[model samples]
Target: MIIVNSVEEFGQRYHSAKRWRRCMEAIANLHRLNPGVCHSIGDSLVYRLVDGAAPAAECFTGNRRYVEIHYYLSGSETVAYAPKPGLQRLAPYSDETDRETFSGAVAGRHAASPGQLLIFDNDYAYQLLGSDHLRKMVLMVTIEGATFHNK
Candidate 1:
């Protein structure tokens, strides 16, 4: 499922954990750093900031073992997503990368802007499209069973 919410709302939902709180704190300070930088806040929790020209076309990717939380920091973009079954595999999911590339028609598109957070689970394939200068922070968290574990 795809969830579009404010970053504050996402923090409220996952704030109980110390690691999540740390991740939230790091997100708040991401603006101070330059673009094209990636850092690991904790085990299974990665923080990535992208600021540059958007992709030329939609390249859908999905993960089976991780949940992705994308927060737009500046500019704007459209996120196109489709269910896994509707996509044709371009690359198989890898345990090291935790991502599988796919190509297909998107089910829908969401206009994303600053302060907006888009959450995607393992069942959906998503692609970011259409932006001249998009600045966003993505937090990829590994999930095990029903528990949300960072390490």
Candidate 2:
């Protein structure tokens, strides 16, 4: 898990920091583009516009196809995160969704404030929640051999 206070921090932590920074700069473009439109820059990298009201995420899920870099531009939320070790399975992984649901105790709570970036690895399970609003972009970077296919 890579947690950074700013995009620069993100750049320092990840190899594709410059590429991720471009995605950060394109938040406005995300608003202009319709939901589900791929902001594809190159192979294995892209971002889709994502936004929702309070309690934006409820269930705990982890991804297999991509590393989830959640950069919040506005609003705030609390994320419950736990290592995916002995977590009980709520649902199996679906290739279509790239998520596996789990039910267990979260070890920590992360503050998802504006300008803060949270990156979850493929095996980390987390849930996002907030009081009134939680708007952010999910920059999905597919791992080796995996690509985000839009349907």
| Candidate maximizing lDDT | 1
> What would the TM-scores of all predictions be?
0.84, 0.79
TM-score of 1: 0.84
Clashes of 1: 0
Residue-level error in angstroms, candidate 1, position 103: 1.7
List the global CA lDDT of all models. 0.79, 0.74
Which parts of model 2 have CA positions greater than 4 angstroms off? Answer: 15-37, 145-151
What's the residue-level lDDT of 70 in candidate 1?
A: 80
Q: Which digits, one per residue and each the tens of the lDDT, describe model 1 over residues 44-119?
A: 5777888788875558989887788888878888889999998999986787778899999889999988888888
List the RMSD of every prediction in angstroms. Answer: 3.1, 3.3
- lDDT tens readout by residue for model 2, 109-150: 987788888888876788876647556777877776664566
Residue pairs with backbone atoms closer than 3 Å in model 1 (clashes): none
User: Runs in model 1 with CA error above 4 Å?
Assistant: 145-151
